[model samples]
Target: MNKLWIVLTYAVFTVLLIIPLVKMTTAAFSGGLGALGDALSRPEALHAFMMTALVVVTVTLLNTLLGMMTAVYLVRGNWMSRWLRRLMNSLVDLPYAVSPVIGGLMIVLLLGPGSAAGAFFDHIGFKIVYAFPGMVIATLFVTFPLMVREVMPVLQEIGTQQEEAASTLGAYSWTTFWKVTWPSIRWAVIYGVVLTIARALGEFGAVLVVSGNIINRTQTATTLIYQDVENFNVTSANGAALVLAAFSIGLMLLMEWAKKRRGVH
Candidate 1:
């Protein structure tokens, strides 16, 4: 029965994942390496990739710092009442509950140029919606939960006993975090970072809406693929998608390695 189940699982995996990846690779290289390179080296493609890298770096950094802080607060901070903690926990998962498209629309409505906040920012010579900053914000909204969820469980499992003991021993709060808490949750943070990078890389719906898909301005790699498909440039789209898939696969491998290291520790 176990062997049968394993066979079925492999069948499912091949049908859903392996076949599509194979198809994408074939299509990406159908015109040969020159075609793939030409597609990726186009000015617009280069800009889109650069924009994606920027968003990924910005979103990953902000999410890592903020998500870790939020997770620690939710799990260990004594300032919150039980109900408030519960409320915050629910809010942290709000992104998961909401559609990325809807999340993008919400940002547009709240911060687009027609709105008061948007107008204020615009008046101050800053743009939020339909720009680079908007793209980062949209991506951040979609990926924030990944980091928090990863760290929260580890924090809960490890508990605050060691942190308290460190405090009792005259360690400063930062010292306690570095000395006692960080080692336990560092792996979880790395996992969260990997997840955040993957999600940010592939995020389409939210970034699409918020970015306005402006070429060389707000277009990300995923959005570039969308644009390629819309323009019936299938080969180009495939090349871009293959690049993203490569990154995602690398991240998956990194995650597996991190898991093994974590287990070793």
Candidate 2:
């Protein structure tokens, strides 16, 4: 009966969360699945969809490479490196504690119109603020710590034995990484990549400040959602929102699959 009560309590909590999500999904698909499909195919909507997709893909790839390298180095290096790792670990807390708008402001202060980097970019005729590059960089900063945290623990857990074993077999570092190291932590890499992608896709406060939201040109799905909702185009906004929610669901499924695969192995 104790087990039964525990299960009942968990079930109640699950239902409380799941009920609203199910309603939203149903509402998104109302007028039938065909309507949802049609909504997703609209031209501006497609642009937003593709832009967000590119952002997720680009950010995930960048974060994975950077995170994997940083995690491995932190695990393998010396005393100075230990200090650097501690610094990075402490820096990760900033994203969680700082307001997104504050992050945007920080970037703007350093890269905005009159700042030194901004002036250099102006001299080169390459605008950073209110542009794609700025948006991508800002999103990268906000979402990066998630990837680092996810991958670092897995790297720490796996340790150097597998790497040492490969090295002793006359394998060079790159060869050993591809041949042995990668296989051991592939799931961790994928999980961290997915988390990075999800966070990048949903980023609003930081992205908005940099993107300039110039409608049909620079507006990402997220910023587009905000613009639509602000303009009272709730239907279109909800449509954009549903696409984002679908991406979120896809991430959840991917994480579940990764967990199952790890269990099976």
Candidate 3:
């Protein structure tokens, strides 16, 4: 009976996930590798890849570094009020609850041409909306919570006992962190960063809302795929989508590997 249930679950998962993935894989390779290369080698497609790389790299770096700091503070900082801590914890989940398109709309409201911030940036020769900066901001907003959530649990599990021990032994704050805390949280940080890379790579709705999807300027790979599909360039779209799907799979595998290495269930 147990084996029967396991088999049933596997069959269900295969039907829901494996079938569609196989279909996409077949479509992506329909024209063969050479055709895929040709599609991606186009100038617009290449520029879109470059733009996406820029956004993913920037977002990953900022989120990983800032997220580590935030998790450390949230877990270890002594807050005078419990409500303030609860509020901060809730804010970390904001991106999960808020729609990505709404996130983009919020950015536009804050930085669009009609706003004072937008005017000041324009006067200073900076562009935000419909540009590279806007894409980065959108991606960052959507992916921000991943790192914090991943590292926060690890921080809480490890606790401040070791850090306090190191400080009592006369180690400086930076020394304590480098020698004690970092070793434990490194795996969680790597997991967070891998997830961030995956999320930033495939972001579409938020970026689309702000990017204007200019051909060689602000278009990321996801937007380029959307445009290609709208123009009925299915081959090009498939190629780009295949690349992103491969990236996501690779990052997911990395995350699983990290989890295994850390002996996480």
Candidate 4:
């Protein structure tokens, strides 16, 4: 029965995921390689590609740094109260539960055109909403949990004895972390970063709400696909979608490899 269930689960998964992906890929390549190149060669599409890359890379770096610091504190900070630690843990999962649309809306309400913060920022000649910065923030908020979640378990498993030993041997705090703690958690960090890239690359709802989807300005690859579909440009839409799918598949493969490597080591 368990074997039957496993087969059935694979069937369902393949039907739902693999079939659609195949169809999408077929649609994308329908016009051949030249057509795909043409679709990507357009100025707006090129801009969207660059913008998406920039946003994903920036978010992944920032989140990795911040998430590692937070995870270390949560794991090693004996000074923190139990309640505070629990609160922090809950907050780490907040983005997971909240809809991305709501996350974007929160950013808009807090910093969009008419709000107090918006007005203050406007006076300072900086805009948040309807800009690149807004897109970055929305993507960051939506993908923030991945890094912390990935690193926390590894940290817990490794414990702090190695770190303490390094310290007692006259290593500085930074040296101790680099030589002792980081090696153990490096694979976890890589996995988290891959997940972040995957999430950030495909982010839509939150980024849409905040980015205003300005062509050649704030539009990302996802938004470009959305726009192309709305305009009934199936070829262009499929091309953009195909690019995103390729990105996701590549990153997912990398993530699985990282996971397996982490387990083996």
Full-model lDDT, candidate 3: 0.91
**TM-score list, all predictions:** 0.97, 0.86, 0.93, 0.94
With a 3 Å backbone cut-off (N, CA, C), the pairs that clash in candidate 3 are: none
lDDT of 1: 0.95
* Candidate 1 C-alpha lDDT tens digits along 1-265: 9999999999999999999999999999999999999999999999999999999999999999999999999988788898999999999999999999999999999999989999999999999999989999999999999999999999999988898899899999999999899999999999999999999999999999999998988889999999899999989999999999999999999999989988888
lDDT of each: 0.95, 0.79, 0.91, 0.92
lDDT of 1 at 9: 100
Residue 239, model 4: Cα distance from true site in angstroms? 0.9
After superposition, candidate 4 runs with Cα above 4 Å error: 1-7, 263-265
lDDT digits (tens) for residues 91-112 of candidate 2: 8768878888778777888998
Ranking 2 against 4 by lDDT, winner: 4
Better of 3 and 4 by lDDT: 4
Ranking the candidates on TM-score from highest down gives 1, 4, 3, 2
Cα RMSD for candidates in order: 1.2, 3.0, 2.1, 1.7
The TM-score measured for candidate 4 stands at 0.94
Superposed by TM-score, candidate 3 places the C-alpha of residue 213 at a distance from the truth, in angstroms, of 1.1
lDDT for 262 (candidate 1):
81
Sequence-dependent TM-score of model 3: 0.93
